[model samples]
Target: MSADVAIIGAGYTGLSTARYLAASGVEPVVIEASRIGWGASGRNGGVVSGKFRIGFAEMARRWDLETARRMHDLGIEAIDHVGETIEELGIKGADYRPTGSLRCAHNQVALDALRAEADWLTGTLGDQAISMLGPEEMKAETGSRDFPGGMLNRHGGVIHPLNYVLGMARALAGQGIRIYCETPVTRLGRTADGIELHTDRGVVRARQVVIATNGYSDLTPATDAVRRRLIPFRSAMIATELLDRPMLEHDRSYTETRRMMRWFRKAGGRLVYGGRGAFGKADSAAAFAALEKAMRRQFPQLAGVAVTHRWSGLVGMTMDSLPHLSRLDDRVTFSLGYNGTGVALASMIGRHAARMVLGQKTDAGLLTSEALRPVPFYEIREPAVRLVAGYYQFLDAIGR
Candidate 1:
């Protein structure tokens, strides 16, 4: 088969790329290794976080003020794009709700930093989408007195992750976009005239290709470039059995501001809480134990709640903590690395990549300004991450 464009991995990034490309009168085909929404896009905390791993102050410090502001706009645009798509496409099963989100500070120092961030957004960037919650308000917002304060973004919400991606696949199909499920692209070859993708079923040739595999980049032999550029870490989550009452006052998404973080929300009348897992383990016994322990530490009242489900997924982390499009070759482009905050970013990055592929104007500040460098100590990243993660956990424990 031959086409103008072929996208790899039918996750949020891939589907978003196809959807936007088709909207522009360009037909694109998507190839997935497994069923649709098989990656992190399908299984996440479901928080619509338009946030970056790097904060506004730090981004400005690293670059310039204008660049930081542009990145800020891009984050907001990402979450907005998701909300608009759900409504515009009329996807009912997505379970989207603009309940807003709270970023809890486990310590007073963290609370102050959160306030400073809010000030920068409002005072510097003129972004008032977020509000600062004091001690009293934090308790009310989080339903826990343990939190000192938080920053609330009404734009951030929750969704049924799997359903969102599936709905997107259906919408793309409605637009004549072909999605080949369980058809893995085994090999990628660069042709003199175009690119060739050797899949399990057949070979496909295209003028250009976008790699949207994200955390699953290493699974495909053709994604060697993407694999080295990303640091894949495991994230585990658990869901409590049906609760007799609501979890929180507002029951929106809640995330703690820390190095080794905990994020959770209420979905399907269950408390879905998640956190970082050891890089060496899978989604079973050992991994879920850490998650349940952390969840219980936060909400010990739920210790008696039965855990109905547990799972793990790889989260691709970038060196810069910014989502980017690296065009190593004109015919090949790679888009990945949301740094674990991709619930809303998946579509946003996809749109940016699609526009760049179309040669249209895109507001990609530092995202495309440079190519991604290889993660340090790539040869032994698992043990390396363990060392770093242990340090971060210590800092977070001491309230640093």
Candidate 2:
């Protein structure tokens, strides 16, 4: 099969890329090893916050204030874009809510930091959409007394992830975009005309190829260099049975301020909670048990609740803790390393990547202007991540 462009991986990035490409009058073929949204895109906590893995203050310290502000604005725009797309496409079953989100602090020190961040966002950066929620407000909103305070971004909310991506897939299919599930690209090579992707079912030759595999990327000689820059880590989530009363007073998504954070939200009358998993293990019964224990610790009211579903998915983490979008070559472009936050950012970056592939200027600002550097000792990332997770757990225990 041949096309103008081919996309690998049917997650948010690939599917959104195909959607945007098709809307631009370019029909692209999307190839996926599994069904759409089979990876982190489907198994996540479903919170759509207007923030990246890196905070605004840290980004400013690392880069510059203006650049940091631009990045932060881009995040908010991404969240708005998701809502607009859902409405514009008339995607059914998305369950998208613009009700906002909460970032709760586990302790007083974290609460202070959260307040300072909120001040910087609203006062210094002129982002009036984010506000500070005190302990009483936090308790009222989340029905959890464990948090001292929190930060609320009115632009963010939650969605039904699987439904959203599936809707995108159906929309693209109706637009005449070819979607091949259960098809894995074994080899990627450059041709005189463009690029060639060797898949199990057949070969796809296209003038442009998009590598959107993210954490589930297959490392071959052609992509090994790019893969070395990403560290794939597993995140596990569990959903509890329907509750008689709503857990939170208000319907909103919530996450902690810990180094290894825990995120939760109410969906379909059930509470879905998720966090970082055992570094080396993909999914385990013990991990789910641990997650349940953590969830109960935060909301003791649900101590005896039955878990209805437990699943884990791999997320690509960059060393610098930022997402990267760049063209690997003249014919190959890629976007990955969302650093455990992909739902909003990935959809925005995917469209940006599509624009890049079409030889159009994208307002990626400072993010896509540079190449991703390789992570040191990339082969030993598993062990290193395990050690880091252990250290973060210790810090969280001490309220640091």
Candidate 3:
């Protein structure tokens, strides 16, 4: 084999896996369809969240409470792992901040639910810094009175996502990990000895192959089992061309929620806000208008903030909301489907993939504890998701 392992996609998962492989004395080759950070890793909301309890109950039921908690802790550990890497690698371009995150409740019902969630998180997750804020407190904290109350998680934060991915690529490439940009893997099949990665540029025969293509799952040949287990969804974001002094002084960008969830941060004189992208191509005037309207509702001071850029990326959603990390064959393995929290979870998953490839096994409850059950009647998932997502946008316009 030319290389011990070949990882497709130079996004967060692929870059992290390459780094891990290098550290473990295995040099892997990475292929990117476009430039580095071209996928969802470069685009999505740049928030590090510990609230990925999506299907928390189901995961607990299947893996036991202890394993579930450990898995949850691994998500938190992923953030720390990224932070440690940033510091160790001396990556300074990515404007990393630990200012924490605020989850706003726009209505009484949402506020009540947030309060309960805060209490539950505090008690069960050993998280205490989560504090509930009233309307006045929310106003004071965010310089907006749009939300009645919210919960602040001090452990969470945000970063310049594109820069972070690029830094990771540089770090891994410096370690002699072969990273090929503008190279797309067309197919992956069984070879005589191991796995073969067929690409547009060349074929890479490796002893092991890691499918780090999270959002671009369709790029790979999905067997019938996988075809039924995962689906791709798109997310969109827009940024204003830096707010004026009044808005800047009055507000510090914070993640907030009403009918639809939004993640935002004030950087480079612009307010970057992101949420579920509308159906179809990313460039939607309606989506940009929706974002602008939401921003105005939150901060009325900046009603005419000009939008500078708008973009979108696909995210892989698994049937159970948890990812599946299993060996498809003898020498091939994959870990994907972040469900929308890949920014914080991909690093840890990549680390685990490294361990899996090295045959150094641990608890392994992070990815495989839950069963890979497809969503019942998932054939209608795409169109149904589009309809529901559009409805949310319409409903959010009315602040419902």
Off by over 4 Å in 1: none
RMSD of each: 1.4, 1.5, 2.8
List residue ranges in candidate 2 displaced over 4 A.
219-222
lDDT of each: 0.85, 0.85, 0.74
lDDT of 1 by residue, 1-400 (tens): 9878999999898998888888777879999999998999988878887778888889899889988888888888888888899987777798888888888998989899999889988899888777988889877665678898898878778889999989989987887899999998989998999999998799999988999998899887888888888988899889999987656758689989987888888899999999886576465587688788878878877867899998889888988777778686788887888888888888767778888888777767777885788887789888888898999999998989
- What is the Cα-based lDDT of residue 19 in candidate 3? 84
Candidate 3 colliding pairs, count? 1
Q: Candidate 3's residue-wise lDDT over 118-160, tens digit each?
A: 7766777676767887888777777777788888777757778
Q: For each candidate, what TM-score against the reference?
A: 0.96, 0.96, 0.90
Worst 10 residues of 1 by lDDT: 277-286
Show where candidate 3 strays beyond 4 Å: 53-64, 220-228, 246-253, 364-366, 374-379, 390-400
Clashes of each: 0, 0, 1
Candidate 2 lDDT over 187-274, as tens digits, reads: 8887889999897788999999998888887434445656888888989899999987767757788888898888888989998899
Report the candidate with higher TM-score, 1 versus 3: 1
